[model samples]
Target: MHTFGSRRDIDGLRALAVIPVVLFHFGFSTFSGGFVGVDVFFVISGFLITGILFREINAQRFSFVDFWARRARRIIPALSVVLVAALALGWLLLTAKDFSELGRAVRYQALFISNILFMRQDGYFEPASDLKPLLHTWSLAVEEQYYIFFPLLMMLLMRHVRHWRWLLFAMLLVSFGLNIAYLERKPDLVFFSLPTRAWELLCGAMLAVLPASKQAVKPWLYQVAGVVGLVAVLVAVFTFDENTVFPGWAALLPVLGASALIWSGAQGSTWVAQVLGTRALVWIGLLSYSLYLWHWPVYVYANAISIDGIQHWEAAGWMLLALGLAWSSWRFVELPFREKRVLAGRKPVLVGGLLAMFALAVTGAVVRSADGFPQRLTGKALEYAQARDWRAGQMKCMLVTSDKNLDKACLVGANQGEPATQLFWGDSHAAALLPAIENNAARQGRPVWLYSMSACPPILSDEPRQRCKDFNQRTMEQIRRLQIKDVVLASNWSLYVYGREDGDRKVLLNPRDNAAEAEARMAAALKARVAAIRATGAQVWLFKEVPLQRKGTISRLTSLARVGRSAEGLGRPLQEHLARQGFLSALFASMSAADPGVHVIDPTPLMCAGQVCSIEVNGHSLYRDEDHLSDIGSARLSPLFAPVLLGTSDN
Candidate 1:
């Protein structure tokens, strides 16, 4: 085997990459952009791996089997231990549905495709992502995938192609271009996929293959480069937040910074390098891989058991625990395999790694097939676990922007052929109310037309997607053609006005607009929409949004129940709900007062009382997720719509 002398500065750089990530995941506001650390790691990996591959291939000593075995030895053992530990903890703590999801995660992760699975599930910055024990593994999957194909590509280029460095550079540029191009349209895809993320690693690769200088380099130049690179990385770590469009142009900050640092250190040590090469930083850097692996699951499970969210002091304690676990994992698991003290033979390590992955995959499959062992819970816990299930026909009824066929809208209540006197129109929140509306309409002998779409409000506004604009127009035309007498406007109103708790502002009425501006726009748009429908001689029944529970609160319903803990206080404060909805409440009131034909329906009375907007009633959760009502929760709102459906006074 060939060896490159260890760079203590590089080890210190690893510490730089990991500390921010750990602090960020543990809810440290100071390390808001700590996620950029992953990008730094990518660059380091690309440089180091490419360095080894370039030298070996040039020497005609590169063996694919040997290279893969080394990689397996470095990665598999610690990873397997973490996976097993996560599954064990999940079984004890996770709800059946959550456990099932974890099982699915395990299956995909075993195949190094967890990034794909996560891309389809949740954005990395989403509040719910904190619950996923394996979420951090997406970065690992990206690295492993790069390892699988990159060495071969390097060999091909070295053996067959002249000017291989330029080819590698071109590939890097292409990947970066893809990342920037797709960031707006498919942010999640760009964030998780190897195609878009490859450039960061390739940046390091480019550094590796660059010709070494023959003459002595100036110390001043190295010092300047190192300082600038360190500053860039630190700036990104502090200034960037969840709202940043990542792995795009913004990603260049950390990626290039890390590359610069690596390049600077290649010649001779500078003051910046000396600072990085400190004993404490070097020790952390040595444990960086293990620390990264252990920290996320530790944070996830720690948050899972907490009644309220994890406090800062609690987070600090948990972080220390994660550090301890990481140290143990590095000491006992990572070092043994990496040093060839265990699974010493190449074939044994390779075969053993494959077998372990297969075994874990099979175990995941069994857990999934058995539905996460639902028999583990009983009574209220079981009920809460099942609460996430949407109403049976919701997917069919709630159209997406792409679904253009208005005729495909699900008809509900009375006979199918009956002329619908009432219409339910809005977004997914409206669809959640279908069960209540259908039951009430049936009792009142009134058929209702449903024209609901996901993320599309009932208001007429060009600010939303063009598809939404078209959907609203077609629905308006339908209301006119059918001579509908009543229209119910329902949506998660706060979502459009304030966006998600995780700083996702894209769903706002005008994502570019300020909060006050968005509120004003929403008010004007909603009023215009209501007046337009009223002008057509149809009464507008405006349903206010249900109380949105605190982030991760809904999932806690089942998790708390799983451990036989009372979920009595697991709800958002009524005052907090009122404060969030204050603008909408005032708007609805003004609209109703201005035009008696428009009636306001407030869910607060039904869903909240005594300064608390409870998520549960009689051991059953009212919410399916954070905001949307479950079927049972929706049925609870039957009385609110009963009078309108029956064409009687609400009193």
Candidate 2:
């Protein structure tokens, strides 16, 4: 069995893994599977470490203390320096909350268990996962978890079996089976947990079990297979995305590919391995650990600070700069302390190192509290977080879940003096119109009944009616039973009016139509629903859909004022990046036809000046989250209710 890693190949592998991960982070269109580099590392680590275990057991020289000590020596000095440096640098650039989260990440990193920490933090595969600076540490945690149990398992297995091959095969089978099962039933657990990851390591162990004669097999066939393996992994990296279920059967392409290259055992003689396992590449690989540690934090910090996606060429420059920083850290901080002669193998140094790591971790967590770092400059970040509450009671909603539906709670204004009130009903986007609904009710001096459900449009179900049937029934029952006089129907009309024809589920998350079918369906649905709802005896006031806004209303106002656009509070018309998209425009094209009961309250004046929709009014957030308006933003409806709800207003 191999006792030590071929430093050149190992380094080459490191180079391969880190490059794609870095490129992907910079938002490169290619190398989506660059993330598989982590898997490659896992396989390499498993093979090398398992090989080490096999040699020690065969020679009877294995000692757990010494093994763990070597691990501490190899992992801690460089890791500690990176964490502390990241924390210090992060303090300068990060917001209070970002700093706070950085602190928590640092602490968990110190213990080598950040995967579990993060899984519980923002959810496993959320879009927000991109924001985490220390996310890469999950791989280290997985390695540490394996290290904790692997040596003992090796010791026990050696006692039970004389030949190591049988034992390795059994362990491989167990780990692989666990991975397959977890991938299907619990992918998140598989993503973060070590049990699911052990199989990758076992693949390496399997490599070590092969006899030396087998390793030296006819070189050309080995050369061909090894090259094929590496290419397969690269192809997978180039094509795959985060949405792919990883470490599953699909992962076999990359893992087995790496394993095949390893099993080929090129030994620097084979032409392909010679170029791949070159001194320069290996040298870069030797520093790959440090590079991996530094690259992610730099990218995350850039994103947190940038106003938008960093332009492509600008991100490329960051990669070069990150390489420089990593090389410097490796040369200056890691090499000197790692040597055995300087510290004389004393135990206190380890203790000191552990304590120092723990300290940095603590600093990361505390630095993001309400009064944490930069909060002294920006007041309390927690207080700024309070801005979400600005639109709280002022607007009533059907579901507190999504802005796409109207929630019953937001129409509180409609409950003004009267015990009984009018009922408002529609899909999620209807929530945005609640400010106007409540305003009109308050003017009428009566309460308004509230009913809202996500994706439950008021229109009768069309063609395929599989989902939300019971929800529609419940909504219909409530509308008929309530002593309701008026119904305000508002929605992301583009979603319903332009339904899908290809497949039932809407592939796009937003309300816009990308293809011909969605646009057509969106318009047809709006027309039919408005006409049908108006058919009811109730007075139907259709609030023309509100424009979807982004950016904080306050920040936009602040920016406009800085440019003197808001000099008289008349900011230059906000850019029309997105107009009232899809069906809302089509509905408006044929909508205004002097219908008395079917009144359409359009916020075109408040939202659009000329043709652009502004996200801010009076330096406030227009939408609380995504395209939905904030509590203060709902006040934009005040104008629509001028003659209907309140005497004067803004929507």
Candidate 3:
């Protein structure tokens, strides 16, 4: 039976794993690939935990009870405290929807299945994930889940297989192969699922089972291996970004690097080990587990409060705060529980851990059942909170991806028996203008058919989004069949021309085309679409895209109002909005000049007052969330629509 001594370098390695993650979460652009720290941690965990299991199994002293008890004591206490804290703070800060989501997260996290829950939601690195306080727990959940199955698998191998290392190597290859196979098709599953992640853990397990004497035979080899491993981890940290497809082939760098570092430090000391064993790195490493737990929640809360996003210096302050919390959690909660001072007996500690987890799960369920217990908010807080419900009751009119018949349910202006004279065709923006069209068309005694879909451009372009193509084709068929005369085209045009405001930085046309070429394609498509509409004897009315609110107007306004803060600078600048409109504006001008059937309707003049687009006009929010109009905002445009559709004045 072989027993391993504690390595200070391993603790320093923990520091290396955590610092980059903290820096990355804190929004430091320099550490874009700092997310690889989690991969490093995974390898370290596999090495240490496997080493313990291997040693115990060889000595014939391996106890599932004892192993689980140790895991419970190590993981449960600090986690419970963090959960309680998150519950308390979330109640105070989070909106009802956010709080409800938090409740769901809390339940999933308590069960140690948050990885599964998050898999169905946003990508880990997405901006939307920034606000989720419990997001980091997914990794802990993955590790704990591995611990549950790995020890049993290892014991079985020890009992039957004479060459157990070969089985481990084979399992590693299988898991790696599985990850590679589904890398592109199911990247999220590869990222969050245990099946694909098992290879990373097994990489460390392979190193642990190897003979220590064999590893220490050549001191120069350890030095070289350790240095190369350190460089590999650092390279992954510096070079990787959100665009990089991960954990298939890309994960090899950090996993192998961490394995090299662990193997080199097994017996003989390398130069990398000496550097890692320094007091500063070792101290940080000692607090690494607790630090990892605390940092993300701190960053999340900081982001939730700050409108523009947490500044670098403010993020530093939050990091310091996390450090203090980590130190306190480690010193008070973790150390005592680990040393058995809090729950002295193994059975007692195990019971206490189970009870605590159960209590947290119960609390989470209650929070969810109570619909986030919205009674915490009152008056203006409640008003702003409720403002987030910005759907504008138009879902029935918007043609979903699954919807087949365009004529069946998408009419907006009049009853089914009335022949539709006007057609509104575009994306969600066209749906947003439905209320005004309904009111105006009723006054004119003419039905207006609304056929719209979300994230679909109205243009007949060679863009790769087939859903848009299918919807537009069906809409054109309906227009020709009904002989619809007045056709209004509206869309969030910037998204197709310049990419999404929140997601992609710029538009991408084809794999081969540049931005200019893509713009040309968009312009040509618009012209062709206009000519086709004119051929059907329809006068095309193109509504200018609404000014986008950079800061989420309603949510931001609500958050600010809840704290008695003024939302003076919450709206997007008119100059920026106009600049984004430059290309579209020019295109519309050229189209109107060339075709007598085409008319441009500019909402910019009415929407923007002075140099700013007012998010709130006359105590009513002009925006529902960011870009889409609220019921009030849409109704306000009814007078504008009256003149165009009914050929009558507002009076």
Candidate 4:
């Protein structure tokens, strides 16, 4: 049953997956598709594991104890070393909070449920993209979950059904259908869930049941199909990115490519298989287990320590170190633990030992994560957590606060489809000024409409953007047709200043001249905007450049924790972490140059001092993650908007 021709093309495909995944993580510009390597791995895992199960079941030699023991020999020894070493490294390099986070991830990694857990917690928009030590482990957890349930299901199918192949096929169809449907509607769920990923493994299971007799195939056809399949998987590895919805139809490229290569029957003589099964690829595949384990955490810790982004060459070095360590383990620990012929019954005993180690991991995660886990308490840290925007339902506000939520009642008020006492027009930059608007409107006792969208500046659509274009077009048409007054012109005007601006950035908006001309054009646009509204008997006030933040304060703060810095007595965490926020400094400098009189209200003084920006106010956080001003920060400065709106300063 195990004598089917070896497929070298599939190993070629594995090489394809690993290289791109490594490169993309290392910061290469192209090949966002490199992430699809994880999908390719999934397909390969399904095929191999299923082949083992089918061959054993067909020979009537399948045993749960034996199968699990084999998995222990294959996966556990190197994994234990990585986990134990990563835990120690985490404590050394990670700050208190970061260490605690690592502890929890280690715990989950032990339990094999980390993918679902991580998904239920953070999201893709988080600033710490490459900084997570256990980020790649999510894929490992997904594979382990399949390993846990799949073999049992196969065993049950073989025992219960006369037509077991039909049963496997039915299960495959169901799992695949669920995968496609879930990815489209609930992507985050699809990314983590066990059921959604089961089909990829089942595809391999299907291949195992197929006839392996050489009489069933032609050599040329096998070669051609194998090449196409391998190439398709490689193309996917080089082409996909984080934005690509995965495990749905998009995942079929890697999954089917793997299946075709297996079915293509590349014998030992086949160059693709020879290369795949070569000393290097299989050696990496052997270490792939270890390489996968060690690479991500070290990379994450490195990102946490460095203010500059994690570099690709740095990842390469770490990968080499991981490879070296994996080789040592393969020689010293793996062989002794698995080769019972040499080590006697020690291999089986080692299996129990590794299982016990996993149990210990579960225990540690549980202990550390508990509410009263001993020795981890700091009252001040608790206070800081409480003040974070999390409890106030502001998670949506930070992650994707863009103007997409116009349907929210807060966006539109007494003034819709017609004139009212006031109209609030602004971009997300203007949205920051909302607490100010709310207060100003209350003091004035005027009816008001809050029209704001995230990232979209309140400007006439000279051109279309994904969000700003439709929002601006609809708003301008509404205000004009409704003859609304009290229009406030504001935005992160730093993005596309009015005039022709020549800078390092070629502005995506209408082309402008030099930097000074850009400001003038922006001023002209503001003036024209005010004039257009005034033509309908309206008043306009422009909120000048809101103080831009330098770095993602929280992530950097976590980084600081990764170091040995006391979060205490740090003045303006943003200032402390500013290197990460140079993008904002550039924008703020551009906007400061404009000084546009669509009422240049400077809230900079409220958040900044001389050259520094603070992240704490009255013992509360002033910024949420990085760019967003916190409720405390926003509220503290809300009253500052009073003078501008009441005509006490500029209306």
Candidate 5:
């Protein structure tokens, strides 16, 4: 049903696509643009698949069933092996919450809707992506989805349209146009969806369907084309990064480059063909698909288990292991299915594939429904696993990005005819203190107003976050409108000063400056916010952020404890925390010293004892997911708020 003959150069192309992708995922800085490898793969797939369809359709021998069966045999066997291995390993290594999330991912992968699932969740480049073992499967989902519709669409065009090239070109233009249009506003959609990505494949299809010229071209021209194409791919692999607006016009570099190499190879002998036709390159290319399937999960689980995170050397070792796994999978799983050695008959192979897929889906559903099978954890691990639940009612209290209906409904304290005397303002960190504030206010017999927005710092700058500046302005007005006398300001201040896990960063004062300048700008913004609070006739109490736990605090601690091991030296050093917060701390102290109306309440001393901050204290977990305090942890801060709420000096 599908044959491209022996194109060793194409095999080399596969090597080109897989190596950089593996390198990039392994965290090699040199391969920053290595993610473009996916685009390269798309081009090669489009070319090869389109060529097969074209040949079969023209010969009047095309059968959708055979094509699909071939695809299933090629893809499913190794995929099933990897998925099963991941599930088994996940049962052992992942925390209950993470394992449950993995279950959801597995379900999506089985349904071949992982791309849509990922698009609806975080972007692929997000740091949390490292945790998802099935994250790489999104690309497979996209490719599968494309093949589902593409052959049918091509058949229709071939039957109806006199000139299919114009139709293909038109479709390409629409997809490319849509990609450009949605690049800024809907980047995730563009990145994950088939519509925006189809053009890259179409670029190869256009090449495949073009009439080959009989006239001989100069060898140097082919050489130049191959060189330029190779350079384009290399440049994109090195130059592009997580910050790049991808799959837009920027994708042209690798897409066109891949197209050029294919064209140059088809024309005759070129330097690229000579280079790509090497035995070693072709072998790696043969292993590329299996390699791609195995690499990400290997990296994900490896990183998950490492206490300090994977180093470059460790990553290299993992890469070697991935290569070994790829070879074994290719030799044992993929080849057996492809050659019909194991599932010999077509009906048997298809049935086996269907059953395998169904079993994986059922397993995934069970895992998800069972809440990642929490029974796997016991004693201390179970206690710590349950600690991740933050009972602060985040969606109700925190202002989401699209929130326009600003209702003062997030009131958290005493309510029996008592006016709201205390107000809390900041980001999600401020929201974490809700339990403590509610406890303290209930004891003091006072009502507290709680308002917060996630990832939006309480800085009064022209920060261009989604509704951040506007939200802060409205919050200030609300403070004055309510005539609140005591206002508490808190946030993950270091996050704003530094950046988030994803590459997205907050620009404090000046967008066109260094980190030191940004820190200065942030300090000034804090002072301005403080002045605004003072102007509202409110005593501003600056609540210092809690000590950050670096690894998955409670989860890591619990997982290790289950096996009679401890996550020692896992929490961030107290000195490192202090260093990150030094500027903010100084500003808070100076502001407090300058005005009687301003004060500072430090949570660090309470949370951290000497050298290290504790994830758990005396059998109770202090922190939740890496940095946020648990409900129990938040409750422990009740004493700090009591004096401030009672109109007594915290000092």
Candidate 6:
């Protein structure tokens, strides 16, 4: 019904937004903050879509059906192709469990709620997210959710509210405030939810609806604005990293920067605009949508199949493949649907899009219900696929933060009704040792009480979580009350002291503490805890943490099996494992020497040999994930605890 001329600079801006995202996802260090490209895309979408809505509404030619049909035509065609292709690829490459997850992701994406699905699954910056081929679709989902609602809001406001601009501004402010307030408390929710992300889009909407300038603006002002805008975006892309608190105050840099560029280029071109309007950039921008869609899956699948991680050269090759696919997808899939050459009418396009989505949803459901077609794999591949799950009843025994009651602890081994003589206590790592402990205790005719909690160490100190403190306190009281003769302390000690590879500070002993300070604090807390346990006349067996594998390494075991590739030499170096555990190993040694009642059980000697700390034993994986031990792996450690279990120790 109405039209505004296309801006080549805006198209080029899309290239600017997408290239960094591709680089970042493919592990380029220079573009660590390339994720801000999504923010740029959001602003551009907001400005263009709002401008069209404003024009059509003003001309009294706006129709909700027409608006939705246009959006479906633009988005659904390429997305459908990607989804189907991803499923086909998944069938060939994924394990049953992973294929099920991919099916679940497809189900959510078809409904335009993959953002919510991912929010509940993993943080955007987490290593696990790198394995997800459709992870980038969350941004698309956010934009689609906006498209579904914003036009109706605009119509309602135009019909009833005279001061519509002020209302929209107030909404933006409210959304931004929510984003900042919950950034620390609920980062995932703030990152994925439409409410918190609305302000970024609203910035562009506000720019579109701003009153036209009555006076001819001086060219100097536009030049200054354009340069500053481009600089702000580039600075964010180069300087920011995963550690940055994002989509809060930090988001203003990209959101306002895109808005300023749009405003500056509204009437005439500046040098910055000319650069953006270059033919190469314009072409990349035209292919941006398909490029974004294609790149992540390419990266994910490539990484999945590699024995080691993808090197820079391998990444470069994969990116070339992505680019070629993006170009083909644009030419064959996006253009025909978008130009209405395939589904030529509004009703046909809308109906066809709906049917496609429905088909995908049903297909995903069937895949999920069938458990990702486990029949697709046999032999070692099937075995590897099944090994990803934790031991049966492991989840039931592991207490999380909310489970504060000590009576809820799982009792294993013999004589369950009588007072327990031994206890297994620590975090999820300790929980993983349940198979070994239970089997040993059963043979010894000793009942062991398990007081393991997720992320909660057995040690007591000034923990940020009061629940952990209380759990530890209750555990101590239980030792005294039960007259427990033995206490095994185990946890992911390195995680509390050094944090995760993804820069997750929340699980650290103190997020603000330096590495040395964290190590010192943990040592002091653990020493004090051992003394407290010794006072109860119980022997403390300090179980050293299992060696951690590199992120995404374990998944490669099954992935390799699927492709008939050997997983030999697929383990971390022993030196790296020893180095990570150096501090803890020395601390455990000192604690044991100080008091014979406190004994150290180091798993390294059994789990490692020669030069490598192996992730598998005789074709069976030792780890269920990067760091946690699998059930079969845990059983291999049964001998280490035999002295305590069988009452053979002199202590």
Please report, in order, the local distance difference test score of every candidate based on alpha carbons. 0.89, 0.64, 0.82, 0.61, 0.84, 0.89
Q: Candidate 6 clashing pairs?
A: none
| Cα lDDT over the full model 1 | 0.89
lDDT of 3 by residue, 89-117 (tens): 78877777677888889999889899999
Candidate 4 lDDT, tens digit per residue, 513-553? 66566555555555555656666665555555554443334
Each prediction's RMSD to truth: 4.2, 6.1, 3.7, 9.6, 4.6, 3.6
lDDT rank order: 6, 1, 5, 3, 2, 4
Q: lDDT tens string, model 2, 208-245?
A: 75666644457678778778978878988898887777
lDDT of 3: 0.82
lDDT of 5 by residue, 438-515 (tens): 898888877788889877788787787647877888898898888888888989887777665454563334546567
**Clash pairs for candidate 5:** none
How far off is residue 439 in model 5, in Å? 8.2
Off by over 4 Å in 5: 1-3, 391-428, 434-487, 493-539, 547-565, 572-583, 605-620, 635-651
Candidates 4 and 6 compared by lDDT, better number: 6
TM-scores, all models, native as reference: 0.85, 0.78, 0.89, 0.65, 0.84, 0.88
As a TM-score, model 3 comes out at 0.89
Model 1: what TM-score? 0.85
Instruction: Write down the RMSD of candidate 4 (Cα, Å).
Output: 9.6
**Model 4 stretches astray by more than 4 angstroms:** 1-13, 95-99, 122-129, 214-216, 266-268, 340-554, 557-598, 602-624, 629-651
lDDT of 1 by residue, 109-183 (tens): 899999999999879999889779999999999999999999889999999999988899999999999999999
Is candidate 4 or 5 superior in TM-score? 5
Better of 2 and 3 by lDDT: 3
In model 2, which regions exceed 4 Å deviation? Answer: 1-6, 85-104, 120-126, 266-268, 341-346, 360-384, 391-415, 418-485, 491-536, 542-619, 641-651
The candidate with the higher TM-score, 3 or 5, is 3
User: For model 5, what is the C-alpha lDDT against the true structure?
Assistant: 0.84
- Give the Å error, residue 394, model 2: 5.5
Instruction: Pull out the clashing pairs in model 1.
Output: none
